[model samples]
Every structure is written in structure tokens, then in C-alpha cells.
Target: MLHIKNITYRVAGRTLLEETSLHIPVGHKIGLIGRNGTGKSTLLKLITGEIHPEGGSIRLQNGAKLGVLPQEAPSGPESLLETVLDADIERKNLLNEAETAEDPQRIAEIYTRLADINSHTAESRAAKILTGLGFDFEAQQRPCSSYSGGWRTRVALAATLFAEPDLLLLDEPSNYLDLEATLWLENFLRNYPRTLVMVSHDRNLLNNVIETIVHLDQLKLVKYNGNYDFFEKTRAEKLALDAAMAKKQDTQRKHLQSFVDRFRAKASKARQAQSRVKMLEKMKPIASAMEEYSVNFSFPSPAPLSSPIVTMENCEVGYEATKPILKRLNLRLDMEDRIALLGPNGNGKSTFAKLLAGKLRAETGQFAKSGKLKIGFFGQHTLDDLHPEDTAYQHLVERMGNGREAVVRSKLGQFGFSKDKSDVAVKKLSGGEKARLIFCLLSIDAPHLLILDEPTNHLDVDAREALIQGLNEFEGAVILISHDPHLVALVADSLWLVSGGTVTTYDGDIDDYKKQVIDQARNGGSGNSPSAVSEEKQPNSGKARGNSKEARKARAEARALLAPKKKAVQKLEKQIQSLQQEIEKLEIKLADPTTYEKGADYQASVSTEIGRLKAEQEQTEENWLIALEELEELENS
Candidate 1:
């Protein structure tokens, strides 16, 4: 067991934790959660002894070993497999000593230590971890310097997991993982036989792996004995009860004050008034919970489009004058299409999304789209393109040429930027803030199609939920490439498998894909033959396979069931568009200088009308999401 008693930590004169005590039992899986700046990472650092507390003690077993994933990847010349194996310090030291030991006794002692540390299986264990994290046999043998920063972080995570310490601390372990790898990691952590503490924003991971939640609020730690979902519900109830109790206290205080005010001037009630004053002084104050800003914005509805928004016929997509990563692709996207591209890392999911978004040219075959098609593409490096010197307001103003400043500010506010936050330079913004700004820019001028590559990379849980809501309400085709299973499962109506230099529609859902990955890993990672897997498991095989009359009839029936849902989604989209237009018109009126120059009553009326219009718009968007979700469920089913 680990015991933290009366510990306090301060940074730059700001107190993060004040005299907090926590006891984590042995082998407990705990999730540390809070807002982005609430010192979740700092707590992990304190546990790892990277930093020290200002007061109190953190106690653990005498011989306890800790394994922590480094925030930055270690620089070295070691190969990926070698880097992981090197995490076993005892094994490494023993081997080193045995190489130079002159005495037989010393050699025997070194060998004994090596066996105790299970050094014989270290290489194979490292290799399995690397493979599970999307590294192939060839890539695992390559030098660590050959990989990118994101891949390097994954390598560090692999090493940490392979270390197998008595205590493990992981901070956002799934940040750089693909879906298949994330699923594998989830299974690995579930069976981890040690005290584990992880900080993550992935809801699926928290729900599946954690048994307790440690919520850091107001410089204190509050423990909840449940998973993430249970914590959410319990926290909501607690907050509600606190609010009610505070209201009751306020009511009693007001009544006492009224009595004191009425009789304090009279000699007869002077003693009673003095007593009431003492009672008021003795009352404990109830602090209100901090208010968190929420993001509530929707993508502007795209222009009308008919069926077949985009089409590809025997298309080959790759870099210019190079071999294509995906080939012989035949796909069509309609206005109602919601497809998620699934595959291992470097297996061409992003290549396919880029091809659909027109970011890449087809090297062979024909790729065509409607003449009115407009695409909104969001790549992983989109944040890097942001100008550090520019403010969020300036970026929006530049995109909306000649637009009014008030309207731009209003749009920023909807994306969770306050008036002051809108003026700050982009460089000063956090990663989650930057991601929200990118989403704001992407949706400013809505397109008929959206192609997103790892859209949730830096977003927190709140922002991710907002993105899911927006995508559900979006009235356009979407081709999403993401590792977030929660978001994919909620929004994707179809799955497209991109592997082995080809692209085809997958006939199963995300759960089925996860099961296949786990099975493959357990079987030593050999079941990646896409064609064979699709032929054996896919209910509706691709066009390359011959179709029977029964298959044709089944396809027709599925289309027939989907047609009504599509119409319903279209109807909701039109309603949302109409409401949004009304809200924008009201906002424009409120922004006018002349309107404010009128009487105070007139300005007040304008503000009230704008608020009412915004409320209506919010409700309409909710309706839109419901319609879209129902449609997705029907299609996926």
C-alpha cells in the first residue's frame, strides 16, 4: 500500500494540493482526473520523486519499484526492441557485471540475479509489446531515432509497460496509439498485477480499466469507488445536493436578517437582534462549485447536394511518382455517408481520407466529385499551421473577409473562448484550446464533405464530446480517421478497412474489429490478411466478389430501411439551418452600434431576443443530433 499523509504541494506560489491525504491499497487501479491545469501531471511527478512536496510525507514499502512513462521520449541510439529491454535495470546490470567478472563466485552471483529478474524472456516480452503497439518486426529492429516524436513516445510507453514495476504511473497512455493498439493496451492494463495510477481523458479506457476515481478539486482529492461512468453520476448527485443545502442555508440566513432588521431599532427586541447577529456569525458558509465553461457550437449546414457527393473508380492514392499506399479502390460517398477508416498505423487510413478530401491526387484510375463539392479537411498537423503570433479572433477575421468584429467574437464565444481569451496569442493557448480553435476554423464555412485525420488528438474529454455532438448534427458526408473508439462508435454509420494497399468497406462494427485485433494478438500477430478476413467474416462482401441473387435482395432491403432515416436527417438539417439563420440575424442586430445608441430598454430587448434565439438554435441542434444518431444506428445495424 502507498500512503500519502498531510501532503501539500505548491508551484510558483499557487497551492495545488493543501494538506491532502490519500491511501491507495495494493494492486488498486486508480484514475486521477481533473481539468487540464489542475496538476494531474504534477501529482504523478510527485509520486515519481521528480519533484518534492512542500510539506508532509509519502510512504511506500521499503523495496517498492516504480515504473513511469516519461513525458518526453529518451534520446538514444538503441533499437526499439533494445530500448524496451533496457528498461529492466537489474537484468542490464547483471549482464554487464558478468562480462567482466574475473572470479567464478562473482559470475555465479550475476547469473543468479539475471534468472531472478527473468532476463531470459525480456527480448520476447519487449517484442510482443512493440508488435501490440503497431510496430512490425522490421520496424522493431530499426533504431529509435528513425521514428517521429509521436512514435518515440509510443516506444517510451512500451518500455514502461515492459519494465513491470511494483507501481505503474501512466499519463495519457493512449495519446499516440491507434485503435487496435489502444484495445490491446486496455486488455494488458486490466490484468496488470500491481498498484496502477493512470491519468487519461479517454472514456472507454477509464471505464474498462479503472476501479476507482481520484478527482482533484479545489486543492483537495476526493475519492469515488467506481469507474468513470459511476463517478460522473455520483459527482452530479453530490453537486446537486450541495446546491440544495446551500439554498436552504441562504433562506434561513435571510429570514434571520429580516427579523433583526425589523426589531433591532426597538428596545424590546434589542437582545434578540444581538443574539441573531451571533448566530449569523457562527454559521458556516457553503462554497459554490466552480463554474466550468462548456463548448456549444454546431457546424454550419452545407449547401444542398444530390446523391454521390464523391466517387472513386479503381483509384490508386499515394505520393506523386511513388508507389501507391492504397490501390484498386472503388468507393462512393453520398451526402448522408458517415464512414470511419480503420487500420493499423502506416496502413493508409490517412492516405484514403486525404484522397477523398482532394489533398492527394490519384496516380491511376478516375476520381470524380460533384462540381459544387467543397471539402473541409483536418489533418493531424493542422495545429502546426496556426500562426503563433496571431490571436484566435484574428484567425477568424482573416477567414471571414470583411465580416463584422462583433459577429466574429460571438462565434469565438460559442467555441468556448471568452472575450479575453479571444485576444490572447495562439502560442499561449493550451493544446485543447488550440484544437478547439482549429475546429472553429474548419466549421466557419461549412463544406459538403469533411475528412478528419485523428481529430481528437489533443482535445480533452469535454471538447471531444462537443466534437461528437457537432459531427452528429453535421449535414454532410464525413470520412473520419480516428483512434477514439468512443467517438467512432457514436458517429460512424459504416466502417472502411484500409490495409495491404487497398480500401474496402468493412461489414462489421467497431466491436467486431476490436475482437479481431485481440484474437490476432493472442495468436502471435499473423492474421492481418485483409482479403481472407473480409471474405471469411464480412457479411456483405465487396464488389470484387461475385454477388448472388440473395445478396442483391438483402442489399436492396437494407437500402429501403435506410431511406426514411436519411429523409428524417435531411429534415432536421433544414430545421437547424433555418434556426441558425434566425440566430445570426438577431446577433447582427444586437451588434449594431445604432441599436445600442437607442434607449436602454431597446438595447435590453435586443439582448433578450438574441438570448432566446440562441436557446432555440441549441434545441434545434439537439433535435438534429437525435435524428442523425437514429439514422446511424439503423444503417449500422
Candidate 2:
């Protein structure tokens, strides 16, 4: 749907894109992946015609619709719903025109075009997208101004989704998404029925969404017809091959030059040598693309000692104690706690995190932080903590405490801030630069109680993965609140579900958390009882919000009709039993010396298969119970 030819763009005397040509064919869900400051955002602008390239052309075929998930909020005091629905202004205008047609023929014509215009019906579309993107009913009603910057970005996203453009351009669509929302979005784009292009630092999201990798480097584009993993493997091989080819060319050129120099002095061999020299001079050099070594970072090693990390009892926390966001919350952290704090917006995930960090106090509760809890809290608004006036170095030194000048500089270098940027004031740094600096500052101590509110915010994919790995390896308690489903899945072994102004503990599974959170919200807000996988609901479909008392009755009826069969439930129980037995047999075999083949392979393969079976069994059992409960509730009536 979009085509670019030799597009080159530059700003502030630095080239962003040069001789970059790409053809984005119709209906391809393309994920734009790259490091921060590598012009992923700039490329999106070029495609949308918001920013023009200095050279070449970006051509979009006629009748193609373009949509972009805007990061910057356009001037507005609208509610989240208002902001999203406003994107359909053109349709609203057309709808208005149709209402007042002057003649019968005109009325018929307007009626014919009415399908294309439905701004009045935006409330339904906005709700559907917002719910899919992780907003509950309470959040949907919130004014955009009241939301934090991250939540506001979600509002902007809802607006973008509402436009229903043929070419969807998403920048960090998963930044505010919970696991449920991320999966919903994945399923949406997977069946988007149009073209997709997004810039994300998320590996799983990119792998699941995009078919090709468009590598941007030194103002040139290299298209790899592969996913992120495929691109990485291919990229290494391609570079090695290029290096060898370049070396061979250099050797040939050197040999030709030496022969020319020596033979030039001999009358008999001069012509042949001269011919070789000319041929060498005329040959185009085989230039190798620049290869940069990936940077590595290390957090300080911990001293041997403590076990239990952070403990909370009867915690009633919020900005104030009497009016708590969460009440009667109890939690304990072992030495190796990989806890993910999961919930929707305004459900007090960050508030609870801050309370744990001792940054804020619970109004009416006791928090006994175990044994000099070396706390490292990653604020959701990581960039906001950075002072505009202070240099990145100054913040690092101030928050991270004094380190050797060389050591401090080295830490900064790992995050991509070089000699000059390392010293540049945090105020002057770009949003992404500010986020990178936060990583350098926050991990300075390797505190036992590491509280990360939203570490991945504003980070491109590579930096995000680096941060996730760094967190994963730390042998301390981690309390992280993030919307990145993949990150949560990778790091969390436990979950704290904050919902309905109450907190509950659950073992962490990214998919399970989503199902429970949505189930709770659906029950409370909509009185709807739709099964999780039952034809995939779009009740938030249509073009309106919902229901009266009687409508709820219909939803309750639909819920009952789809309840699971008793025979199927019995079969699932048997499958679960068989799987458990098999897992036990594998464990016993792996433990014995003779039965195991290839220590690592046997252990890894068996463990992987066992984990998958266990997960499937658990899900089947949960779905069965929910279905049974619905049936019982229905039959009683």
C-alpha cells in the first residue's frame, strides 16, 4: 500500500535515512525493530506524510487509509472516550450531512454513503479498542488530563485504533498493555484485514506480528525476509561473509599494486604489470558495512546473607491512609522473588509498588522490610524523575552515589551514552535518552528489593531485552509493574493482582492473570458472563456501550448456553491425570544415571514438554470449572 524510492532524510546536520528504498505491500503486518535513536519513529513519520524526506518520494496508492498511534497528545481537555471518538470527526460530519438531505434522491445517496460515516457510533468502537488495549470501564470514563503520561498514551492509541485506517502505524502499542490486552492486540493485528507497521522493542511481539525485518543502519535499509530471531542469525552470517569478501578484495588490490610498482622499473614486464594496476584501479571496492560490538553491563555482586526480603501486613496504601487505593493487602518476599504486580490502569499497581519502595507510606498498615532491604524501585514515569537542568552524569552520581570517574563513565557507556552525551544534562536529553540514563542510574546499587514500576517505558526492543536479562539474573527480590506481557512472562514467578480497590495473591502466569483480571472486570462492570474463548467477544463490538437490567439477562442466558459438557470435563480430568503421571515418570528417569541421554538435552527437553502439558491441563481445568459454575447457576433458575 505504501512505496518509497531512494528516500533520504536528514535533520540537525545528521542523516536519518539515505538511499532507503522499501516497498510495503498491501496487508502485511510489519513490525519496525531497532535500537533507540536509530530513527524508528522518524521512519513512521516519513510514511504518514507528517515529515517529508529531503530526497526521493513516498507514494501511497489512492484510496489507502493511513493511521498512526500518536505519542503526543493533540490539544484537548477531552475524556479518554472523547479523544478516541474525535478521530472519527470526518465520519461524524458526513453522518450529520446525511441527516439533513434536501431531496429524496439526495437522501438515498447519503444513505448509500452512511456506512462510511459513523462518528456517532464511535463510543462503541472506542470502548472495544480501549478494553482490548487494557482499559476497563472506569478507565474509559476518565478524562485524558487525569491520566498519567503512560495512560494518556493509551488514550492516543485508542484514538488511532478508532480511525480504522487501511495502513495502521503503531509505535509501542504494547507500552500500556497488560497480558490480556497484548494478546488481544496480537489477535487483532493477526486478523487486522489490512496492512500493519509498528515500532516495538518487544521480541515476542515482533516475532508474532511481523514477517520481515527492515534493518536501518547508516542511512541504508537492508530487508531480511525473516522474523527478529531469523534476522539476528542471518545478520551474523551476512556480516562474516561480507568481512571475508572485503578482505579478499583488499588482498587482490595490494598484490596488484606491488606487482605494478616492482615491474614498472623493468622494461620487459612493465606492460603486463601496468595492465594489472589499471584493472585494480578500475575495480569498485567491496565495501563492508560497519560492525559495532554489542555493549554489556554488570550490576554489583551481592554479599552472602539474607533470605526473606520484603514483607507487608494489613497494608492499606494510597496517597492517604484513611482513603486507601488498596486495603488489607498482605505480602511476603523470599530471597529470590520474581513477582509481577498486575492490574489495569488506576487499580493501584504503581501506588502499591511505591509503598513497597518506602517512597510512600500505607495509611493504616505495617510494612516490615526485611534485613536492610536494598531497594531499587523503577518508577513508571522513569523519564519524569530526570531533571531537565541536571546532566545525565550528575543524576547518576547523585542517585547512584559516588563511584570512580572511570567506572561511572563506563556504566554510562554501556547504556549508549558516549563521552559527550554522558555529560549532557538530563533536561536536554530526548525522551528515549532520558529512559536509557534511568537504567544506568537505577541499577547502581543492586538492592535486594528492586522495585521496577515500568522499566521498559520509552525503551526500544534491544535496550528492553538487556534490562529484562539484567533483572532476571539478579539474585534478589524484584517487584515490577509493567504492561509488557513478554517481559512479565520472562521474569515473574508470582503475581500480585490489584483490582476493585483490593489486592489478591496469585501464582504468576501471564495468560492466567489476564483471564482473571478480565473476568473480574467483566463481572463487575458489564454483568456479562461470556466464556474466554467463546467465539471471542465483541460485545464491546457494535457502535455503543451497553445495557439495561434486561440486557444483562440475555448475556446471562448466552453464558449458560455455552457451558461445558460433563463428558468433556471428565475427559479433561483424565488427560490431566495422564499428563501428571508422564511428568513424574520423566522426572524419575532424568534423576537416574543410566536412563538419561545427553544430560542437558534430556533435562531441558523433558522439562519443556512437561511444563507445556501442565499449563494446558491447568487452563482446561479452569475453563471447565467456570463453565460448570455457569451451568449450575442457570439450571437453578
Candidate 3:
């Protein structure tokens, strides 16, 4: 329940939002998206009152609490769990008062409030959020100061989730997360009971967790009633129609002007020419849709090399000689291989990348690469290595050997840099532009192999798409490490798991990996029963010994007691299915071009019906999840 009316904000002599109004309904999940440097983050700050808008107003529902991820990571001495529990100030204050209250009435009121807030289960809830965010139980008990800034930032995110404010604001919550933690967060936010507005470049997250999209384009906020894909399709169709209408209007105007031009000089046709001029003056101009400049990346194709470009045998890699982070990493890379590395953060993915990039040598074992192979490595940390005062041209010049200035400028042009942009200092460029410059520098020689470590971290949705295309077009070996599932799914043909101090071929898709990660989180990290390298799982000895007469009897009784809950869940599932079918039919109607050709009233009614059905479907899904959780609790008890 947030309302932003005619808000105008400006910074650094540039307008980011100009009289743009947006309304977020209660209990709705919205994704705020735009190109990079378009002020998605700035809008979030305006809503949180971190920065005041120059005009208009922003208002939230009275007494509604707001939650935002902390700008700075925690550096205090508090334990991670304590820091998260402290987020619920009401619960903390009430529990403290309960322990010291002398009056019987006051004690009773305090306990009542604690129960209302479920304060007894607060610690477990906080731990669950922390675990989903990639902290184990033991780590949760450690002091926040013991962790790095990135890990501490995760603790701050956990606190925000534990607080469960009425309105939550997240700005690229998955920027620091791996694929596993990103999936967990997507599931968590889908079931969040309050209102949420997130700014993100991750398309999969926006499509999965969000019900609505609010796009910031041309200094305006435009709302669409669907996920990111739906928004894209709908916007494209609208623009096509606008272009067609503009064309037709332009043809009519030209004809009218031609009549006046040819006849206004003749005395006989003067009267008719004057009438035509009036007609032309009265015609209102129809604005055509202007095309925005799209960013493109072109990776030069390298000369074909022999197969098995790289081979590693029993390789151990780490910073310390005695402590190897990745052990027995036996792997091979062919000239045509496109491999995606999958695992959680701090699980040796980056270390493995460094090993391939020649940054680190094998401590013990044979690691070989083709003598003539040239590798282009793009590490996430390399973004910081850029000289702030150097221009893109200068950065390229330093690494471009004795290449001519014309040749260097041409290379920059392939990465979307214009003459003006190439001369701008690195500090003046946006994140995406800087990333493009990195690409230019790395690919200058057209290396035989490419090792990209989190290359999409600074890219927006469009820029990511461009990168996927560029990677596909490049004829060289690739090893990718990224959190963007959509990009990985498109570019990678093989999956490798770098987990549990080893590397292995993962014979499954991203979906399987997602389920494994979720299962592990749900079962306290003991759900690694799935085969790490193969789809077939080994037989469990415990399950074989678990079968007994008494166990069967207890299970039967538990099932009997849980039948009502199961029935409620099934009934809601059927209702949801029915509503989904109805919504699909309405969506199909809306997608047809003929629908928009109808009167505005008719289209409006159709859209209104779809919205109503979707709202009901959301409610049914929530009820089903609650019933399922209750059934699980009963079974566990």
C-alpha cells in the first residue's frame, strides 16, 4: 500500500523521474525494471525517504512498517542470530517487559502479545531465513564481525526477511547471491504475505516471484499486469500499433500539404488551396514510437584449435599449500566446450575459474594446456582493477600492443562504444559500459579459450541478452560462472558442480540443481543423497531398516488424523487449477490482435476479469500452502 503521485526527482543535473506516478496495491508483488543507469535504485531511495523528491508526494498506509536492506553491512559484535532477532523490535521489547512485569494484568498482556507475534518461534524462523540465505547453524551463532562484508550483507538481508514488514523493498537482492541462494529467495518471496516492490535485473526472479511489472522508461513509470515476459510482449505490440497509426497519419498529412504546395501559387486554385491549408493546420500530429539504442557485444571468433585444449589430472587448488579448497579436480576442456559452473558461493567456483585462467598453478598434480592457446579471463574482481582516471581508449591502448589508433577505436566500436564514449573516463561510465570495456580488453587478441567469472554481474537484462548472443557466436571454448540462470541456460551446454571440496560432471539441468539445493536447505544440509555426478541415487540403508510393524501402525494413525488437512489442501488445489484454466482462456483472448481492435470498454472488461481471477488464484495458492504446512507439522509431531 504505497502511493507515489506526480513525483519528480533530479540528480547531477539529469532528470531520472519526471512527474511519474505509481501505485502499489496492498499484498501485491511488483518488479521494478529498467535499463541500467535509469534510476531504479534511486526510486527505491525516494520511497524509503532516504532522498526526498523535488516535487509531489509519496505516502504509505498509516502505521504500516517498511523494510529495506541495509546500505552498509554489519560490523558490530552481535551474533548473526541476535542481529536478525533484534529486527522485530516489538517482539523484543515485549519479551523484555514480560520478564520484569510485576503486575498480573501487565504480565498477562505481555504474554498475549508475544503469542500473537509468535515470538516463541522467532529464533527458528530467523535461522531458517539465514540458512536459506547460505548461512549454516554454526555460522549463525558466530559474531557478525567474524564474517566478511559480503556475508554480513547477507545477515542484513536475513534480518529484513525476519522482520516481515508490511511493505518490503528489495534492490537486486540476488546481486550477491549464488544460484542456489537466489532460488531459495525466489521461493521465499513468492510466499511472502505482505506487499513487495523489487528492482532487479534477473529476469527469472522477476518472472517467478512478481505478479506485476512497473517499468521505468523515458522518465515515466508504466504499469503492466503480468510478469516480465508478458510486459515485454505487450509493450512491443503497443509500440507496433503506434508506429502503424503514425505512418497512416503521416501519409494523409503529406497529401494535404502537397495539395496546397502545388495549387497555392495559381489564382484559379487559390480558394481550394486555402481550404487545404486550414485542413492541414487542424490535423493533430500522431507521435511515432522512437526506437531506443540497443547495446550489442561482439566477441571475435578465434582460429580453430585442436580438441582437448586443456586437461587437469588430480589437481588441487587453494591459497594455502596444506589446505586445498578443491581436491581431485580432474577435468578437460575441448575447443568447442561451453561449460557452466554451478555451486554455492565460497564453494570453490571462483577458485576453479582462477585455476583455468592461469592465475594459480596446481599444487600437486598435472595440469596442461595447449602451448599455443590464448585465454581471455574476465574475473568479477577485475571490474575494480580498472583505473578510475583512465579513459576506455587508454585502457585498451595499454593492452592493445602496437596496434594503430584506428584499429583500437574500431575494436571499441564493436563493444558498443562510440567515439565520445571511448574518450570518457572510466569513472564517468556506468557499470554496463565499464563491463563492455572489459570485454573489449579481454577479447582484443581473439583468444582460443574464454573464462568468464560472473560476467553478468553489472549487466542489465538487455545487456545480458546481448552477451548470450555474443558468447554463442564466438568460436572458442568457454567456462562460465554466473548467478543469472537465464544466461547460463542459454549459453552453457554442460553443467559442472564445484561443491563439497570436489568437482564433478552434473548430469542434470538447472531445475534439478535447484531442487537439490532446496532439499538440502530444508533438511539441514543432510539431503545430499542425490548422486552428485549422476542422476541415479544410491540405496539408503536407513530406509531399509526403517520399516517395522510399529512404524507402519504409527504412520497409519497419523494419516488418519491428517486426512482433513490433506482434503482441504486437495480442494484448494482443484480451485486453483480451475481458476488458472479460466485465467488462461482470458489471457489468450487478450493476446489476440482482434481483442484490441474492439472498443476500449470491451478490452477493459476483459482485462478487469483477468485481474479478478488472478487475485482469487493467488489467495487459493496461499491457503493451499498453509494447509500443506499444517499437515507437515502434524506428521512431524
Candidate 4:
């Protein structure tokens, strides 16, 4: 167990977290969530002991261990496996010492120490976890330098999981993972024996992975017992209630002040007025000080289309002329197709999209575009479509050639481009700002076919949801190439699964598509290991629990089979109770039916009702037996 007691944190002379106290119980899977710049990462660093808090203590039990996924990596082309194993060099050293203890007495002491250290067994478990996390056979030998920044972080993540510490701290862990890897991490975190805490923006991941959410707000910490969805609903209600209370308090405060002002000079009424004033002064101010600033974004609509938006025939594309990323691909895009290109990073998704958008010519085939197909492409990096030389204002103006410059400037302003920032060169923009600008550009005219490449790359979960909403509402066609599976699932109508210099089309949910792909990978097919594609173990794709359709249908069928049986059994039990009551009444009257007034008539009526009940019960019992048999048969089958 670890306790973060009365902590204060300051950065750049500004208080970040003030007098924050949190108790992390042993074996809890906690999630640290908050808006950007709210110190989620900073708090993680504090717990990891990377930085000392400005005040208070992070207390851990004696001999307790802590692990964190390093926010940044050391310079290296280190092999991925070697890098992961380095987290426990001390344990490795202990193993080495135990291996060579020479004197008999020393060896005995070494054996005991080794036995104690054996409980941690980080190295062995790390290897197993790395394997489960989708580390390919070669990952053990691959140098860390050969991997991308995301994969390098994955290497660090795998090592952290391997470290087998008492506490696991992850910050925005889903940032670089593909769906498959994220799913794996979710399952592992759920099953992890150690305490768990992480910061993430992924809604589904947060909902399923953690039991509690802690938020940092206005230099104060607030904790919620439920997941992100619960937090949102409860927080909204709390804020509304707070606002109402604050309004009432304001009204009372004004009334007290007005009375004091009107009567301060009146000798008879001065004491009563002053007493009211004191009550006003003593009243606690309400939550009127909380900010209402919301994150807002909107993109321009594109022009209408005529017909035959885009076409591709025998298209061949590749970075190298002969080494084709994709070859002999036949594809068609009409006014209604919303296509998502699916593949690993090295595959030809970007290359194929570029060909369709007319940014590049197909190396060995022909393609055509009919109608007024104005392509709005959001590339992987904002810099790809942005010009460093032009300001945000000028960029929009230049792109919208005939449009009035004033009108263009106002549109840019709508996207949070204003003041000196409107004049700043595009090169200096932040990732999210750049993404917004790209979105704005793409929105103009509602192009018939929108070709987006990693449109969600720099977007936060909230902004990504906005983009998805806009796309869903567009009525226009889309061809997007992205590695972010959440975006793919949200916007993609169908998948063009490309791999190993070939392409196959699949029609289904992104979740199902990924399941088949992972199953293929697990069975040793063309799909690269999820670990090799991105960092962080995949979150639960929700497929590993079982095939979705099969599980759903099985549950439904079970209920269907059991329903009639259950109804029949209930009817039989009610009839049995009624029959017992009637039999007792008849037995009581049997000895003196004539003595009681109208006793014979009452007995006949009761017998008739009881006979009908018994017949109906027999019929229901027969049906119940048949239904139960069928239910059992279905369950067995």
C-alpha cells in the first residue's frame, strides 16, 4: 500500500496540485484522469519518486517496490528485449552472485538470499509478459534504436510490466497502441496482482480497466468511485446543483448587503441590519468561481459532387519502384463509399490514398476522377499539408483563392486562430492546433470524397469524437488511412485490409475485423505482431472474451429455450398450492357436510374448482417436462 499525504506541487512558480492527499490501497487498479496540464503525469512522477513533492510525503510500506513506464528514453539502438531486461539489473546481479558463491557457508547464505529474491522473479515473469504482449521471436534481439518512438515506449512499457513492482503507474498508455495491443494491456491490468494506476483519455479503456477515477481540478484533487462515464454524469449533476446553490447564496448575500446599506445610519434598526451583514460575511461563497471554458472545434464543409468521384484500376504503389507496397490493386470509389484502408505502418495505406487523391500517380496502373472531386486530405503529420512560411491567416487565404481575404480571416478566427497567433507561421503551431487548422481546411465545400491520412493523430479523445461526429454527418464519401483503431471503428464503413503486398476487403465491424486479423496473427499468418506495429499492449478488443456474435446468440438462445419451461414450472407450483388448500377444506367438511348451512353445495363447488386446477396443472407439468428436456438438449448441444 502507498499513501500520498498532503502533497503540494509547483511548476514555474505556479501551484499545480495544492494540499492533495490520496490513499492508494494495496492491490487497487486506479486510473489517474484529468484535462491537459492538470498534472496527471506530474503526479505519477511524484509517486514514482522521480521528483520530490513541494510538500507532504509519498509513503510506501517497507520493502515495497514501485515501477513506472519511463516518459522518455535514453539514446540508443538497444535491442528491445535487452532494454526491457535492464529494468531489473539489480535482480540480475543478485542471481549472478548466487550462481558463484564459492565457500560452503557463503553458499548457504547465498541460497537463502536467492530464495528470498526468488519471490520477485521479475525476469522470468517479464519474459512471459513480453511474450503475451505480442513480442515476436525476434523482439528479444531487435535493438531498441531500430524501433519508432512509440515502439521504444512499448519496450519501456513491457519492461515496466516485467519489473513486477508493488505498484504500476502508466500515463496515457493507450497513446500509441493499436487495438489488439491495447486489449492485451487491459486484460493484463485487470488481472495484475500488484496495485495499478494510470492516466488515459481512452473512454472505453477507462470504463473497463479501472474501478475508480481521480481527477485533478483547479489545484485540488477530486476522486470518483465509478468509471469515466459515471464520472461525467455525476460531475455534471454536481456542477448544476452547485450552480443553483451558488445562485441562491448570491441572492441572499445581496439581500443582506442591501438591508445593511439602507439601515446603517438608522439608530433603531442598525443592530439588526449589522447582524444580517455579519451573517452574510460568515456565509461560505458558492462554486461561482469554477470555470466554464469548453473545448470547441468545427471544420468547413466541402462543395457538392456530380458523379464517379474516384476510380483506380490495376494500381501499383510503393516507396521503391520495384519493391511495391501494394501492387495490381483494383479499387473503386463512388459518391457513397466511405472506405478505411487497413494495414500496419509499413503497408501501402498512405501510398494508396495518395494515388486516389491524385497527389501521386500509380506506378503501374491507371486511375481517373470524374465530377468535381475536391479532395481534403488530413495527413499523418500536420506539417505534411501545412506551409511553414505562411501564417494561419495567409494559409487559409491562399488555399481559398477567390474567397475574400476578410472572410477567410474570420473563418480562421472561428478555429481559435486570432490575435498575434493568426499572424504566426504555421510551423510554430502545437499539434492539436495544427490538427484543428487541417480540419478547418478540410471542412470547406464538403468535397464528394474526403481522403484522410491519420486525421486523429494529434487529436484528444474529445476532439476525436467531434471529428467522428462531423464525418458521420457529412453524407460525403471518405477514404481514411489510420493506425488508431478507435477512429477506424467510429468512421469506417468497410475495411480494405492490405498486407504482404496484397489487399483483401472485409465487410464488418472494426472489432470483428481485428479479431479475425489477430486470430490470423496468432495462428502465424501475414499480419505482423501487434507489438511490432505500435507500443503498449493492446487494450481488450472485446473479442478475446469470445466471438461476439456467437456469444450473443448463445445467450439469447439459452434464454429462449428456458423461457416456456420457467413459465410452466411457475404455473404448476401455483396449482399445487391451490390443490393442497382445497383438499384440506374438503377433508374438514367431509365429516359434517349436511350440518353446515349449504355445506354440500360448498363442497361440490370446491371439488369442481379443485378438479379443474388438477387437470390444468397436469397439462402444464407435461409441457414443462418437454420444455425442460429441450432446454437441456440445447445447452448440451
The candidate maximizing lDDT is: 3
Q: Residue by residue across 161-210, what tens digits does model 4's lDDT show? A: 87778888887676565555666676677778888888876776778788
Task: Name the regions of candidate 1 deviating beyond 4 angstroms.
Answer: 10-14, 285-291, 526-637
Model 2 Cα shift for residue 30 (angstroms): 1.8
| Model 1 lowest lDDT segment of ten | 543-552
Give per-model TM-scores.
Answer: 0.83, 0.74, 0.80, 0.72
Clashing pairs in 3: none
- Using TM-score as the measure, the top candidate is 1
**RMSD of candidates 1 onward, in order:** 6.7, 17.5, 19.7, 21.4
- The TM-score measured for candidate 4 stands at 0.72
lDDT per model vs. reference: 0.84, 0.71, 0.86, 0.69
Locate the minimum summed-lDDT window of 10 residues in model 3.
541-550
lDDT per residue for candidate 1 within 42-62, as digits (tens), equals 998888888999998888767
lDDT of 1: 0.84
Better structure of 2 and 3 per lDDT: 3
Per-residue error for 221 in candidate 4, Å, reads: 1.5
How does candidate 3 score on lDDT? Answer: 0.86
lDDT of 2 by residue, 53-125 (tens): 9999999979888898765864457767767877876766666887786888987777666655654466787
